[model samples]
Target: MDTVLTLAADNLLSPLILFFALGVLAALARSDLTIPEAAAKTLSLYLLFAIGFKGGVSVSGHGVDGDLVASMLAGTVLSFSLPFVAFAMLRVTTGLSVVDAAAVAGHYGSISIVTFVAATSVLESAGIASEGYLVAVAAIMEAPAILSALWIAARFSADTGNPVDARDRQGLLREILLNGSIVLLIGSFLIGYITGEDGLVEIESFVVSPFKGVLCLFLLDMGLVAGRGLRSSAKHLRPGLIGFGLLMPVVGAGAGLLGASLVGLSVGGTLLLMTLSASASYIAVPAAMRVALPEANPSIYLTMSLGITFPFNLTVGIPLYLSVARAVGG
Candidate 1:
């Protein structure tokens, strides 16, 4: 408990979190502070490329083995299954329609790359080593939750007026598979793997030195976006909705812990897995939702994922996961 509190405190005080807080406060106060859209996009690309490249480089050194394959399988199972858990919880606890619940559930099940990156940063700061192939795990986790959500909506929801046909399914699949973030992540990972240690050493100054600074700025932009969503969508945030938003991540994390134990992940890898499961995908899932479930309320899912859960994970969930991983895996 003390270790968790100490780590949480340190994370909350870090420059990345502080900058995010600043953006949130600025947005809430209606200040004019903004990150240009292009710059924000560039920062996101750079982070994805850097993280993916490093993970590939690590894989180059570690080599493909049973552990890598096992972790990937674990991640896929978690992603495909978590939305059902979330949908059941929402049905029990909240008044969300099946479509909305499923949409929100999809976000929870999908991995948030930014959150994964943030966890990596935390692990690095704590001098912990984790499996770099987890980047590939992250990429693999993105699509299954979305498919699960669509399945749930089609299976349970009575309102099938806007039913997704075979063609629609094809398009959604294409979008998920070709998402820019996934492309850059997998592409960079392959590049790094092909180049190996020599590639990393040559580009270390560019990707490593500026990583935190870029992350801080990107998070600041995220904060701004989240704060604005919260401010505008306050009316939609009922107690039940808010409760689910806060509670679902912990539930997801528990599932992740089980997965980690089964796969025999080390403490750092366990923490990363827990973080990935706990995170809500504000980026990829939301984009997919906009296309697939247009009737589902964006304000609800977006506010819950980005405004409420994202900040909570950054401030508290990561530290708590780390402590738990240490206790269980250390």
Candidate 2:
């Protein structure tokens, strides 16, 4: 208990957590703050590249293993299946329509890159190592939930109009699979894999050493984005909807812990998997929903996930999960 408390304290003291807190506090205070969309986009790209490239380099030395494959497969399966559970839970627990329930569930199904990054920091602080191809696992998790959400939305929102337009459908599909963040992440990971450690040598100055520093700066921007999202949507969200945001991550993390145990992941990897399971997609899913399920409230999902739950998971939840992973993953 002392150890858990200490780690939790450490998490709260971290700059990443602080930045996230700033977002929540600023939003709750109704600050008129904004992060430029272009800059936020660029920061996200940088974060993905730095993390993916580093992971690729690490994997270059580690190579692939059976357990790694098992873990990835487990993560993928969880990503695909968790939404149905979330959808069912939401329908029963709240008054959300099938479309809203499924849409929110899809966010739970997908992975959150920032949450993963935060977990990686916690692991590093604990002097633990995780597999790099988990980056690939992260990429894989993003799309399946989207399909699940769309499937549910289509079923419920037949009357929402223009459900089957070819051009729009194809574009959203392409965006889902080939989204810039996912593309850059996978592309950079593969490039680093191909280049190996030798490749890292050539660009180490760019992707290494300064990675965490860049994360701090990017998180500052994320703070602003998150704050803005929450403040603007504050009036629109009901308590049940907001409560759904908070509850979903806890449910998802419990499911993730079970999955991690089945796959025999290390503490670091297990915590990361749990974090991914708990995180919601502010970027990809919102964009996709805007294109596809236009009636589904972005503010409800985005604000609840990004504003409330994100800071919670980043500051308090990651360390809590790490402690749990250490206990269970051992």
Candidate 3:
């Protein structure tokens, strides 16, 4: 308990979190602070590429092994299955329509790359080591939730008019698989793997030195966006929705803990897995939901995921997961 509180304090006081809070406060106060769209996009790309490349470099140092394979399989299973759990929970807790529930469920099921990166930063600060292949796991975890959500909507929802046609499904699949973040992440990972230490040596100055600063800025932008969403979507913020947003991540983290234990992850790897599972996707899944479940309410899902869940994970969930991982997996 002491350790958990300490970690949480440190995390809350970190520059990243503080900047994020500043952005949120600024937004809530209707201050005109903003990161330009293009700059924000660049920051996103830089963070993804840096983290993915470093993960590959770490994999190069460690070499492929059974744990890597197991982690990937476990991640895939978690991604595919977690939405079912989330959907069931949402149904029990909230009066969301089946489509809205499924849409929210998909966000819970998919991994948030930003959250994963933040966890990595936290782990780094703590001088902990985890498998680099977890980036691949993060990538793998992005799409399966969409499939699960679509399945849920089709299975339970009475609305049949918006059924996705074959072409639409294909396009949605392409969008999921070819999302720019995923592509850059996987592509950079492969590049780093192929080039190995030599690649890292060449680009260390570019990718490593500027990483945390970039992340801080990106998260500042994220805070602004989340704040704006919350401010504009206040009407959609029901108690049940907010409760699910807080509760579901803990449930997902528990599932991740089980999976990580089964796969024999290190304390740090276990924490990363837990963080990935706990995170609700605001990027890939939201875009997919827009395409695949257009009838679903974006304000509800977006506010729940970004405005509620994202901040919760950043401020509380990651530290809590780390404490549990240290207690059990350490």
- Summarize candidate 2's per-residue lDDT along 104-179 as a digit string, tens digits: 8888898789888878877877799987778888888888888888887787666556784888778888888998
How far is each candidate from the true structure, as Cα RMSD in Å?
A: 0.8, 2.1, 0.8
Comparison by lDDT, 2 against 3, better one: 3
Candidate 3: which stretches are off by over 4 Å?
A: none
With candidate 2 superimposed using the best TM-score fit, by how many Å does residue 249's alpha carbon deviate from the native?
Answer: 1.0
Query: Higher-TM-score candidate among 2 and 3?
Result: 3
**What is the Cα-based TM-score of model 2?**
0.92
For residues 145-253, write the lDDT of model 1, one tens digit per residue: 9999989988999874688889988988998989899999999998888999999999999999999999999999999998899899999999998999889999999
Model 3 TM-score, 2 decimals: 0.99
lDDT of each: 0.93, 0.80, 0.94
Model 3 over residues 158-240: C-alpha lDDT tens digits?
Answer: 88357898999999999889989999999999888888999999999999888999999999999999999999998999999
Candidate 1 has what TM-score? 0.99
Report how far off residue 27 is in candidate 1 (Å): 0.4
- The global Cα lDDT (0 to 1) of model 1 is 0.93
- My TM-score estimates for the predictions, one after another, are 0.99, 0.92, 0.99
